[model samples]
Target chain A: MKKWKRSARLVDMTQQLLREPHRLIPLSDFAERYQAAKSSISEDLAIVHEVFQQEGSGFVETVSGAAGGVRYIPRAGWERSRETALRLCRELENPSRILPGGYLFLSDLLGDVSLVREIGLIWASFFHDREVDAVVTVETKGIPLAYATASYLGVPVVIIRRDSRITEGSVVTINTVSGSSKRLGSLSLSRRSLQEGARVLVIDDFMKAGGTVRGMIDLMSEFRAEVVGVGVMAETLTEERLVEESASLATVTDIDVKQNRIAVQLGSLFR
Target chain B: MKKWKRSARLVDMTQQLLREPHRLIPLSDFAERYQAAKSSISEDLAIVHEVFQQEGSGFVETVSGAAGGVRYIPRAGWERSRETALRLCRELENPSRILPGGYLFLSDLLGDVSLVREIGLIWASFFHDREVDAVVTVETKGIPLAYATASYLGVPVVIIRRDSRITEGSVVTINTVSGSSKRLGSLSLSRRSLQEGARVLVIDDFMKAGGTVRGMIDLMSEFRAEVVGVGVMAETLTEERLVEESASLATVTDIDVKQNRIAVQLGSLFR
Candidate 1:
């Protein structure tokens, strides 16, 4: 292997660390890859860590021991998180998002990959130290957010399906009722999707009375998985809240279909 | 702002470039952020570009002019792509994945975030130059893959629902028949999800007779969106094929339910 310059090593190291957040890379691996001394690699890591800390992007955590390695822990700074939450509130406040039956058209916002990633970063930052084994969510709208958060946290995503499909093989199905509309629904998870006793972080695009989230928590019990934390991109203000504790980035305070108006505010995360 | 050291600047620049792939950043922006001269930034970018090119990860593309800037275009090396495809084939060949009805259980593999990201990188490398405006996929299993590919391409994801929901507002629905099973289904896309005449790349987790992909392409027509490309994580071998051109990472050539065996091979992407 050719010797790598310090500048080239720094760029490559930063790229690798950012690419696989929460993954540990041994110092020997870097030393071998760059054909450089361990001392040199340490110096390079310090520079990278300093830059990340200053930018509030994330930090490189070092584990000193035979089985220890360095891992990147991604974080959204308080200012950045607040900015994202405010931006989400503004986006949710658009009158054009108002739909029939008081439902907001959120596909556009959910479809925005950049925004989804930003929100995922915020959730990951909040739950980074929770030792989350997997990020879970119900299928369709929440899959992107779940995947994004899982990516940042270096965990797999276990999706609960609305209807059990043949492709999922054997699944555990549970009946659910919407808290706001009282609509009956079924949530299913593949038997093989999650391991028993694994810690999971729940993520969703929206929460109305927290019915779906509550159902997810109930289903997680079947797998013997622990719900380390729960997060939603946005939650509506409702009189009936099924889930007792959860975090949200934005709140829909009021939506009047007749008046074509919607009121939005920062979620509990900011508060 | 404090003046950034060259090493710190390089690390920060690499992180920003990797975080926002395909987003062009003006040299002046970096100059202002780092309190450094454009000449220094240019020198740093050259080093970043060289490392990326040599590693086959990607290159920093420079658009020289008043309106032109630099952007990171991520690319998976051919060797890496082949390795990922082969690994996927091996994973698919597990006998335990064989379901009673010959449907292979893939939820576990699809739930793996790192593997999904690797596959996404390969797809992005293949379609990065096609100028994909949005990634489109039918709801359920494909949502994660669509989001992953869209994230790599720096584009939004437009999900095509199996059944139009009230939350989608007004949707364009198209009836489709499963080319293999001869089952009828409806594919719906939100009218607001995509723009007229937008270039789209279709992504899915699996393709069997290509019915879903075909339906997605037809639905794109209603939005006047051009189907720039189509990709699937896996495809099944069948006598009847509906789609003419598509890429897959792995192909299940045969499935024996009685014997609980599955024969998997590299998809067209490797060939």
Candidate 2:
């Protein structure tokens, strides 16, 4: 084994930690890999830790125990997250985005990799302390955001399909209503997508009156899974909220279809 | 400004590169951030570059000129990719995964973040030289894989919905057949999801005779977009493949319903 310098160790350690988020990597393993002392490895981690905190990239959590070591927790600072939400609000406020029935044409943002990742990092920060066994979301628009967040959290994503397919084996289907259109819809999930008694974090691209979010929460009960937290990239702001206790990066204050105007406000995160 | 040591600089650089893949990052930016000389930053990048290459993590390319800078290309080495595929093959060989009509129950692997990301990195490496403006995939299972690949490639994802919705505005719908079951199916893509003359890379979770892949390619033509390449996680072994010049990680050779056996083989990457 080669005795790596501090510079080389820092570079390798950062990559390792980022690749395996929420995983506890022992200092002894790093020491052995680089042929450095545990104390020296700790020093290298400290420098990486400081830069992560200062830059609002994430956190380096150190645990002192026989089986414990250092773990990387993906998160962004409060101000950084707020700025990300604000920038999104500006783009979503486009007049052309107003569609029928108060819906916004922001499909582009749901597919945007960088924007989804920014929201994912921010969402991860909020649930860094909670034990999230898996990330769950409905299919189509929300899959990208769910995958992005799951990647940062180093967890699997369970997508709720709109229709059941024979290829999915046995599935649990639930009937729910679309919040925006007030029409009934169905969501199905394969039995194997999640484990029994799993702690799930529900993520969706949009929350229009929270009907879809409520559907997801209700569906989790069928698997005996608990919905620990719910996060959405953007949600509608109104008095008639279907489900409460949710976080969003941006809020759709109003959408005037005939006037072709849409107002997007920074979400509850700013408050 | 406080000058950063070699260890601190390495950590910051790794994080910055990881955050913005395929984007050019000048050494001067790093030098200014750490208040270090350009020469020192170059030396640090060289060390980071060597580690990334050796570990099969990614690539660090350096260009020389007024606008030249280092760009990180997300990829995994051939050996690593092959190993990932082989491991997946072994697990997929389970007889229980066999479904009716030759379909395998692989929704689980499609949702696994680590697995999807590992395959996504490999797929991105295959088309890194191509001018990919966006990733295209059909709705449901392929969404996660498309998003993962798009994240690494730094491109947006355009999901083709099974059914058209008014919320998506004007959409282009195409009729296709299920490759295995020979049943008619419809796929629709929003007119605004992709721009005309754009180059697209198509990704999917499973492929059988490539009917769905063919549908996506035909739909892309409706948008005047070119399909640069196609990559699937697993493909069925049939001499009558509808689309050629594609890549896959694993191949299902045989699935015996009565015998309760499945034969999984390494895909084109091995060949």
Candidate 3:
């Protein structure tokens, strides 16, 4: 095998580490690939780690001993997380987003891939130490955010369907009622979607009194899975809350259809 | 600003380029960030580009002019694409995946983030040159694949709902009938989700006779959006095909639920 120059190796190594976040790659494997010594590889990793720390993007964690290797854990620093929350607040303040029934038009924001990815990074960083086995969310609006967070955390995303389909095989279904509107609904998850006793992080686009999220938590129990964390892109200020604890990126203080006004603030993630 | 060593600069630059796949970044911006000269930045880019090309991961295109900059275009090499498809085929062949009425249990596969991402990369590389303004997919199963492809292409995703929700505001809906089963359905897209005359790439998880994809193409016309391309993770062999042009990663030739047997082949993408 041909040896690689330090410059080329550094570029390739960064790409590999970033591509598979949270996956440990043995140093010997890298040493073999680059035809370089293990010490040289360690030096290269130190440089990458320092740059990542300086940039606040993420850090490369090193493990020692025979089964040791390095893994990239993605993170959004305090400055970046605050900036994202402020931007989301500004976007939510748009009067045109108020609908006929005071519902905010969020399809545009959810569809913005870059913005969704940024929000996902924040959640992944917030829950990085939870040892989450998977990211879970209900269908429709929450799918993108769930997938984004899962991608960054290097985990699979299991979506809960509003109505179970034939293609899902067997599923665990649960009943739910909207906390704010008192509407009835059901959430379903395929039996094979998650393993028993797996640790999961629940993610959603919007939360109002946490009815849907509460339902998700109940359903997770049916499979014997543990709920490690719950995060939402945005939440409304409601007097009655079903979920005891959760994190959100932005808060909707008020929405007035007749006045065409909406009030927004940074969410609990910043706090 | 302090000057950055070449090794550190290469690692950071790679991370930035890979994070935003198609966004062009000016050389001057790199120079300013690294406290280096434009010529040195150019040299660094060349090194990154060479490693990417050698690995068959992607290439960096440098646009030279007053407004010109460099952009990274991600691609999946033939060997890697083939490997992904074969692995998918093997996973699909398991008899446990067969459900009643011959419907395969695909929820597990769809929930696998790494597998879904690889499929997305294959589709993104296949349709990278189409100038896709957005990725469009129906709700539920297709959302993950659509989001993954959009993330790689650096484009937003517009989801077509089975039933229009009030939260969507004004929507354009169309009726659809399953080509294989002849089941009646409807597809809806938010009026503000897509712009008029925008180019879109359609992605889906499964296609038996392309009814869902066909409906999406028709619905895109309602907004005067052009369907630049259509791609699916898997498509079953059928005599009556509704779509004229499409790409797929894997093909199911036959399925015998009673006998618990499924015949699979490489999809049209390889051909």
Model 1 achieves a DockQ score of 0.88
Instruction: Point out the worst 10-residue segment of candidate 2 chain B by lDDT.
Output: B98-107
lDDT of 1 by residue, A1-271 (tens): 8999999999999988988998899999999999999999999999999989888888999999998888899998898889989999999999999888889899988889889989999999999889999999997899989999999999899999999998888999999999989999999998989999999999998999988999999999999999999999999988889998899999999998888899999999888
Q: Residue B264 CA error for candidate 1 (Å)?
A: 1.3
Q: Each prediction's TM-score against the native?
A: 0.99, 0.97, 0.99
lDDT of 3 by residue, B1-271 (tens): 8999999999999999988889999888999999998999999999999999888778888999988889898898889889999999999888898988899988778888889888888888999989999999999899999988998899999999999998999899999999999999999988989999999999999999989899999999999999999999899999999999999888999998778899888899987
Where is model 2 more than 4 Å wrong at Cα? none
Write candidate 2's Cα lDDT for B121-189 as tens digits.
Answer: 888888888989999998888888888788789899888898997768878999999676688989998
- lDDT by residue (A1-271, candidate 3, tens digit) is 9999999999999999988889999999999999999999999999999988888888999998899999999998899889989999999999988876778889889888889988989999999999999999999999999988998899998999999999998989999998888899999998989999999999999999999999999999999999999999999998999998899999999887777889999998877
Residue B128 alpha-carbon offset, candidate 2, angstroms = 1.4
CA RMSD of each candidate after superposition: 1.0, 1.5, 1.0
Which stretches in model 1 have alpha-carbon errors above 4 Å?
Answer: none
TM-score of chain B of each: 0.98, 0.96, 0.98
Docking model 1 quality class: high
Better of 2 and 3 by DockQ: 3
